[model samples]
Target: MVYSEQQIMAWASSFFWPLLRISAMFIAIPVFSGRFVDNKILVGAALMVTFFTLPLLPEHRAIDVLSHEGIMTGLQQLLIGLSVGFVLQLVFSAIIFAGQGIAYSMGLGFASMMDPTTGVSVPVVSQFYLVLATLLFLTLGGHLVLIEMLIDSFNTLPIGDIGMERSDIWSIIAWSSRIFSAGLLMALPAIVSLLMVNIAFGVVTRAAPQLNIFAVGFPITLILGTLLMWVTLTSVLGNFTNLLAESYGVIGDFLRIRR
Candidate 1:
């Protein structure tokens, strides 16, 4: 079929804008953004998703894609996708912070290994929590929900200059406070328990000055911390679910906001 210049531009815009959005999300979102996942695979997935969703998206690309206006529009689309993914990334960061706190309390802070996902060294406790959280994320269909929200976003925000506002940015900043509070709440039980254990060791040391607190207390605390983590797993999972829900809600709010 022969196509005119206008038709060619329209087709290119249709495919191009959605690809930018999808690819940006792939880069910023967890799982897909991990170092293990190949970039070519991500691009292919973005292409496939874009093709299927392109038909559903509104035709608003009347401007020249090679022009300055088109470049700005493309950037705006990328920003919107990245913002959505970044909000969710904060959720996982909160979990990692909680894990670090727990690990430190358990005297395992010095024992760290590289996390394959983020390619950083984190305490074994943090890695444990991350693994469980990732599994829960997938098992609960969180990824599916994310994709659905992304698709719905096109309807809410549309494809144009109308993207995240100043208020929305402030809202994201305000939401960041959850990283501290939520992280603390998740680790609070372990922290309190570990504090009592340390206090007991301190009293023992005071009563029996000849006993080496460093020698005896370290092993006891390490063992107790592991036990405490095992006992607290249920509560930790509950907190993670709550945090994930809140993250999804924040993403929804971001999309629902108007121009």
Candidate 2:
């Protein structure tokens, strides 16, 4: 059977929107978006998904993709995928910031390492929390929930439409504030304990002019920090879990149509 130009355009149009969703997410997401994941792997996944989704996508068959109008449609798909990945990244970064806060309080700020996933230097304590949070995120099936939400986004906004509202962008900005808030909440237990240890050392130093408080103070804070962490570890987990859920909800609300 000979293929007409119209037939070719029909198939090509169907393919681009789905490809737009997959390709945008492939690079924007955290773990899967890492540089270590081969280009071939990402492209293969995108192609595979595009194959299945092409039939299900509503035909904006009338929308000529080569024109200025089509370019705007493409941009909208890009924004939606980027926004979804960004929300999840914020939650993980919140965990990292909390760990850094606690580490600073406990005088362990010097211990830092290059994080492979993010390609930046992070405190060892921060990285540890990040890894643990990743484990917990996977354990609680957060990744699957994120994916389901992404798929659901197609139903809400579809393709070839303006995806973001003024309020949606503000929601992202508002959620960013929680990074500092959640960080303080996670590190508060250790911060309070360390503050008391600092106060005690100041008094001891004043009382004995020759005694070096630095010699004992560091060890005391370390031990107290460890003890406080052990006592309140469950609360930390709970707080992180709540942050994760909020991240999910925020994305959902952002994708929702305004009343």
The candidate scoring highest on lDDT is 1
Lowest lDDT 10-mer window, candidate 2? 54-63
**Model 1 segments beyond 4 Å from truth?**
257-259
CA error at residue 138 for candidate 1, angstroms:
0.6
lDDT of each: 0.87, 0.80
Which portions of model 2 show Cα errors greater than 4 Å? Answer: 53-56, 257-259
**Which 10-residue window in model 1 sums to the lowest lDDT?**
250-259
Please provide, for model 1 over 1-259, each residue's C-alpha lDDT reduced to its tens digit, 9 standing for 90 to 100: 8899998887787788878887888889987888889989998998988888888887675668789888888888888789888888888888899999999998999999998778999999999999999999999999888877887788787776577788888898899999889989999999999999999998998899999899988899899999999999999989989999998888888889332
Question: Quick one: how many clashes does candidate 2 have?
Answer: 0
Q: What is the Cα-based TM-score of model 2?
A: 0.91
The TM-score of candidate 1 is: 0.96
